[model samples]
Target chain A: MIELEGLTKHFGAKVAVDHLSFTVRPGVVTGFLGPNGAGKSTTMRMMLDLDNPTSGTVRIDGRHYRDLAEPLKYIGALLEASKAMHGGRSAYNNLLCLAQSNRIPASRVREVLDLVGLTAVARKKSKGFSLGMNQRLGIASALLGDPEILMFDEPVNGLDPEGIHWIRNLMKQLAAEGRTIFVSSHLMSEMALTADHLIVIGQGKLLADTSMADFIQENSRSYVRMRSPQRERVLDVLRAEGLAAVEAGSGVLEIDGATAEQIGELAARHQITLHELSAQRASLEEAFMQMTAASVEYHAHAAGEHKVPAKAPPGAPGAPGAPDQPGQPGQPAVQWGRSYEERRRRRSSRKGA
Target chain B: MASVPAVLQSEWTKVRTVSSTVWTLVSALVVTVAMSAGISALMKATFDELSELEQATFDPTFVSFSGMILGQLAMVVFGVLVVGTEYSSGMIRTSLAAVPQRATFLFSKMAVATALALAVGMVTSFLAFFAGQALLGEHRTTLGADNVLRAVIGGGLYMGLIALFSMGVATMLRSSILSLGILVPFFFLVSQILISVPKAKTVAQYFPDQAGSKIMQVVPDALGSDVAPYGPWGGLGIMCAWVAAALLGGYLVLKKRDA
Candidate 1:
């Protein structure tokens, strides 16, 4: 287990990490999520004692990192891809040096090499290895000590699909063995697939700490999207049934607080011919964007505006800085529902004008 | 805390596994011996044409080690690479994470590399002296002569110390290119040039190389060189002080800076 309390780091005048406190428990893969420059790397470095925190303490297995007798035997980290190996040295020798330092047996180096599937090229200098190969070598080095805690920063950044699948399974297997697996990535989709629990940060502040399922369920909107040839009758039936139905462009009526099954049965009893009926669940990516929109340091304004035309402006009700409770007043999903109605009214008024 | 022996063993592996260590140390030995032999041969042929002061002050012991000027540069390269490549290749983080004790990691690495350098330096000194003496023919001085063995051993010590000083500087600077940029010109050109200038010679004589080279001379003020206030061992002491200060600075930087 790893615990950080009141961790803070300042780089000159810029606050890189601001009082982050979280615990990564064993027996689960905890995903660290943040946008670029959200202090994820800085936090990881401080955990490893590579960067001195301005004011904080990190305890790995209940002891300070520097105080650990053999740190590698307790916690192993892959900070950046291919950066931890000597370019001029062969992969096997590079790991051997680390093993020797920690007094780990030499045989474990080959074991980790085989574990990462790099045994074939173990004799080759790492400088000549491809990015995928380099990442594998890094993972091999991290696994050299067979530590109980493993941390990886963007491990899947430059990997092929096969490599990605292999790492995903590797982490799951490691976690199944009751090791603490803490990983950081900006890819929400990847996190959704790999992370059992999530500790999210935004602008160096703790945004959310919950399980993967709970985080998505709480922070995102999932509603029943229904379309009927007689859209007016469908809307009337939904309203009569006390369902909060809103017109969601293109003759579709979106009803929250009701399942597709409930909505379909209601439409059938009213003799409304439904053209389409499906549940629209928010993806983890959308949930992540809503949570971190205001804290995104490098906001590509043009790209963001072009891609998400109806995205609410910063400081809008339910935007970042609001409470974390979903479906509450001023929550992202509620504000988005209100905005959709506003947009539809404006479009009809413009036509009249 | 990390075990010192383990750290030392790890550092030894790091140095030996790379090709740069082998190439640089070999070049230091080969260049020093070959150049020293060639110069000794040329000096022997022109001995009769030397002036009175030149003849009086011609120390065969010092002459035999003349190739050190070019050769020490290779030692500098060796030293810089030993510490600098850790930064260049981004392996310092991994190394530090494994050991965690900054003092242990830095000192252990320096100790292993310095031991290798001292070994190679002693062999190179002995070979250069024997080869240069062979080329000198009748002008050669035997190792059995008074002060000859001291000078020979001091020559080896000087070469080893040069490499150690370079390692300290490289660790402080943390980049091979930047350390070489400053150290190469300062050692190769600036130190040599300043030692010859009328007024600058006073201060330049105290420079690490100029002071350290005093140990290689069997005769005082050999070849009409400047008269230093300190004796040979005293001069080496001054160089040792420079190396110590550099290492202390390097330690401070490593302890305080973020990896």
Candidate 2:
């Protein structure tokens, strides 16, 4: 278990991390989510005591990191990739020095190398390894001591799909063994697949700390869209039942805050012939954007300004700020970091206009 | 607190595994021995051209280590790389994490690198002395002579101190390129050139290399150089002060700054 009590760090006058207080409990993988420059790396560094905290303290398994007899055995952290190893030395020898420092057995070096599938290149210089290979080596070094708490910062940055799948499974497997796993990334989609719990930060402030299921249920929106031959009768029935239904185009009535089962049963009682009663649920990606859009630190306003087109429907499917939308001037991912509250105000003004 | 011996063992492994350690230390020995032998042979052949002052205070013991002016640069490289590579390769974070006690990590690394340098420096000093003496022929001074053994041992101490001073500076600067950029030029050009200037010589005499070189001289004002206010051991003591200050500065920076 890692406990951070009011941890804060300041770089010059800028507050990089503001009073971040949370505990990463054992037996589950806790995903740390934030946009770029949101103090994830700084927080991790302080936890390891690599960078002294400007205020507060971090306790690893109820002891300060430095106070632990052998820190590597307690917590193994892979900060940044490739750059941490000695490029001049072979992979095996590079890990050997760290193992020897804490009096770990040399045999464990080979075991970790094999664990990361780098046994064949164990003697090869680390300078020659690819980015994917470098990440694997970093993981191997972190596992060298058989540490109880494992932390990885942006573990899948430059990996292939196969490597990404491998790491996701590895974290799950490690957490299954009752190890505390803390991983950080900007993508919620990745975390959705891997993280059991999430601790989110935005602009150096804690936004939410909750279970994955709760985070999704609270932040994500779901509504039922109904397509009926007699759309007016369906709307009349919904209005009589105190359910507000809007006429979506093409003879469809959309009801907010109602499940498909409830709408279907109501239409059946009303003798309304319904062609479609499908539920539209927001993706975890969209939910994450809504929660964190206001507190994003670095905003990339491509081409001088982002022109939110007037009279356009806001929050529509496939709108800007949606992920996996390629070939934009800048990545639309930045749009996801915009202030959701401010966007709503602009949207209301557009309606007035 | 970490066990000192275990940390020392880890540091020793770090120093020995790199190829730079072998190249730099070997060159410190080979270059000094070869260059000193050549210079001593030339001095012996040109004995007739020497002035009365030059012949009167030849000090073959001092002449034997002449190549140190060039050779100590290799020692500086050795020392700089020992500490500087940790920062350059970004391994300092990993290293400090393993042994979180700042003093233990820094001192253990230095202790390992310094011990290796002292050993190599001793071997280099002995070989340079013997090779230079062999070429000097009749002009050669024996180790049995008064002050000769002290000068030879001091020669070894001088090289080790040079490397130690470089390590301290490197740790303070925190980059191999930056330390080498400032250190190599200062030792190879600035310190050597200032020693030749009449007015600047006064301050140059107090420089680490200029004061430390006094340890290698067996005779007073050897080779017509001006007499220093301090004796040989006192001069070395001045150099030791510089090394100590640099190390203290390094430790403070390492302790206060983020990795």
Candidate 3:
């Protein structure tokens, strides 16, 4: 188990990591999510005691990293950069040196090389290896001691499709063995597929810590979208039923509080011809964007609509009362917890009408 | 805490696994021996053309070690590479992760490389002495003579110290290119050139190479060289002081800085 208590780091007046506290429990892969320039790398470095923490402490198996008899046997880390191996040395020898340092058996070197599928290139220097090969060699090194806690920072940056698939399964297999696996990535789609739990941060602050299913359910908007040929009649019926229905675009109406079954029965009772009635849940990417909209540091101005106005509170995930139109100044903050299917249903109902 | 012996073994593996270590050490030996023999032969051929003072104070013991002027550069390369490659290749982070105790890692690596350098330096010194003496013919000084054995053994220690000093500076600078950019010129050009300049000679004599080379001279101020204030042992002591200061600086840098 790795526990960080109020861990914080500052690089000369710029707060890189601010009081991040969390635990990575065993038997699950925890995906560490953040935007670019977030303090994921800094937090990992502090866990290994490579960078001294300014204010807090990191305990690995209840002991400080430096206090452990042999750190590699307790926690293994693969940093974002594939920089842990000597290019002048062969793949086999690079791991051999690490094994010897930790008093791990020399035989384990060959085992890990085979595990990473680098047995054929064991004698070749790493300088001649491609980025994928280098990443595999780094994984081989990380597994040299068979530590219980494993951390990887952007392990799939330059990997091919097959390599990506291999690593995803490898992480799952490792976590299944009751090892604590913590992996960080900026790609929400990748995290959604692999991670069972998520620990999210934005601008070096902990934003969310929850299970994957719960995080999506709470942060994302899911609602029923309905379309009818007689858009005016449907709107009148919805109003008479005391349901607040907003016209999306054309003849469709977006209702947030009612379920598809309730809306379907209501339209049938009123003799309205219903074209489509389905529920839509926002994608994980959209939920992540909404959550970190204010914390993104490097903003590309090309898409002006994506910009979250500077006045929005950084801690507020989604603030209401923001105008939804583009080209409008002082637009009230975006309303979270509302599904986008309403807008699409309005457009479809207009086409039908 | 990390096991010292384990780390030492690991450092040994790191050094021997690379081809550069073997090539650099072999070149240091071959170049020193071959070049000293060549210079010795040339001196013997021109023995009749020498001036009276030059001929009288020739110092045959020092002549056998003349190749060191060029050869020590190879030693410098070997030392810088042993420490610098860790940073250049980005292996230091991994190595430190295995052994988080900074002192254990740095000192163990230095111990292994320094021992190898000392062994190679001894072998190279003996070979250069024998070959250069054979070429010198009648001008050669026997090991049995006074101060000759000290000069011979001191030659080996000088080479090893040069390499160790380079390792310290490399650790402090943390880059092979940056360390070499400074050390190569300081040893090959700056130190040598300053020794001959009218006003610079006084301080230049106390430089690491100039002071250390005193151990190889059987006669004071041999071959019209500048006379130093200290004796042979004192000069070696001065060089050792420089090495100590460098190693201390390197240790502090490694301990204080992030990997």
Candidate 4:
């Protein structure tokens, strides 16, 4: 178990990590999610005692990292590959030094080499290894000690599809053996598939810490879509029945908190000919975009008509920023949330152009 | 706390595994011995060309070490590469993670590299002395001669000290290129050039190399070089001070800065 209590780090005038506290539990794959420059790398460095925190403490298995007799045997981390090993040394010698430091047996080095499928190139210098091969070497080193807690920072950054599949299974297999697995990534799609729980942060602050299912359900909106040539009649029926429908452009009406069957049945009762009727569930990717956008918006514009209390407070799911927000709804917060999403999309496309 | 022996063993592995360690130290020995032999031969052939004062107080032991001016640069490269490659290749993070105690990590690596350097330095000095004395003919000094053994031992110590000082400077600079860029010239060109520039020679004599080389001189004010304010050992002590300050600064930087 890895516990960070009020962990914080500041680089000069810039706050890299601001009072982060979370426990990574064993027996599950916990995914750490954050946007770019969100202090994920800095937090990992502190966990290894490579960087001294400005304040607070990190305990691995109930003791400080530096106090551990053999730190590699307690917690193994893969921070960066292709740059962490010496180019002049062979892949085998690179892991050899790290293994010898932690008092790990030399035989285990070969075992890990085979585990990562790098047995053939173990004698070759790391400088000649490709990105994929270097990543495998890094993973081999991380697993050399066979520690209980394994942390990988974006382990899938430069892998082929097969390599990606191999790592995904390896992480799940490790978690199945009851080892604590903590991995970080900017891609929510990967997290949605691999992570059992998520701890998300933005702008160096905790945003959400919850189960994967609950995170998507609480932050994302799933609704039904309807398209009818007699859209006016469907709207009239929906309004008469005290149901709200939003025109989602392109002659489609999106209705929240209602099933497609009910909407279809209501249209039939109103004798409306429908062109399309389907239920749309918001993806985890969209939920993440919205949640991260809300955090950025909170940092930029803390006050205005958009009420953070109504939308982000009640089921904030362990967010430290929730209780600090104003505790009343001055206006609907969904309007501004959608607007922020639009702006983010436009800004990204502009950068691409 | 980390196990000191385990860390020491790990550091030894790190030093021996890299090719730069062998290449740099071998060059230091080969270059020093070869250059010393050449200069000793030149001194023997030029006996008649020397002034009356030069021939009267000729220090053959010091002449045998004339090649140190160029050879010490290799020792500097060895020391710099030992510590600087960690920063350049980003291996420091991985190495630190394995052994998080910064002092233990830094000191252990230095201890291993310093031992290797000293061993090679001793061998180089012994070979250079034998080869140089053989080439110098009648002007040669034997190991049994008064103060000759100390001078020969001092030659080895001087080489080892140069490597150690380079290690300290490289630790503070944290880059092989930057450390080599400043150290190669400071030990070779800059200090050598200032030694002939009138008043500049006064201050230049206090430089680490100029002072540390005093230990290898058997004759008083050897080979007509200027008289130093301190004895041979005292000159070496001054160089030791510079090395300590550099290592302290490096440890502080490692402690306070983020990896």
Native contacts present in candidate 4, fraction: 0.80
Find the 10 residues in a row with the least total lDDT in model 1 chain B. Answer: B93-102
Sort by TM-score, best first: 2, 4, 1, 3
| Candidate 1 residue-wise lDDT, B1-259, digit = tens | 8888888899999999999999999999999999999999999999998888888998998999999999999999999999999999999888888888888889999999999999999999999999999999888999999899999999889888999999999989999999999999999999999999989999998999999999999989998887899999999999999999999999998888898
Native-referenced Cα lDDT, model 3? 0.84
Cα shift from native, residue B31, model 3 (Å): 1.7
Local accuracy of candidate 3 as per-residue lDDT tens digits, A194-298: 899999898899988899889866865555667888888887887777676656443546676788899999988988899888764445765676577667766
Superposed Cα deviation of residue A288, candidate 2 (Å): 1.5
Which whole-number lDDT from 0 to 100 does residue A284 have in model 2?
67
> In terms of TM-score, which candidate is stronger, 3 or 4?
4
Ranking by DockQ: 4, 2, 1, 3
| TM score of chain A per candidate | 0.80, 0.80, 0.78, 0.81
lDDT by residue (tens digit), candidate 3, B1-259: 7999999999999999999899989989998888999999999999889888888899888988989988899999999999999999989888888999988998899899989988998888888888888899899878898998899899999999999999999999999999999999999999999999978989998889999999999988888887789999999999999999999999999887777
| Per-residue alpha-carbon lDDT of candidate 1 for residues A1-353, written as tens digits (9 for 90 to 100) | 99999999999999999999999999999999999899999999989888889998899988988887678899988978678789999999999999999999999999999999899998999999999999999888888889999999999998998999999999999999999999999877788778999998988999999998788668656667777889777766766776777665557666778988998888778787888887765455657776777677875322111221132222332232222334423323334223333544554553344
Candidate 1's docking class is medium
Clashing pairs in 2: none
Q: State the lDDT of candidate 4 residue by residue for B1-259, as single tens digits.
A: 8888999999999999999988888999999999999999999999889987788779999899888898899999999999999999999999999998889999898888888888898888888999999999999989999988888888888888888888888888889999999999899899999987889999998888988888888887787777789988988888888778888988888888888
Share of true Cα-Cα contacts across chains kept by each model = 0.75, 0.72, 0.83, 0.80
Instruction: List TM-score per model, in order.
Output: 0.89, 0.89, 0.87, 0.89
Q: What DockQ does every candidate get? A: 0.76, 0.76, 0.73, 0.82
Model 3 TM-score is 0.87
Off by over 4 Å in 1: A226-277, A303-306, A309-353
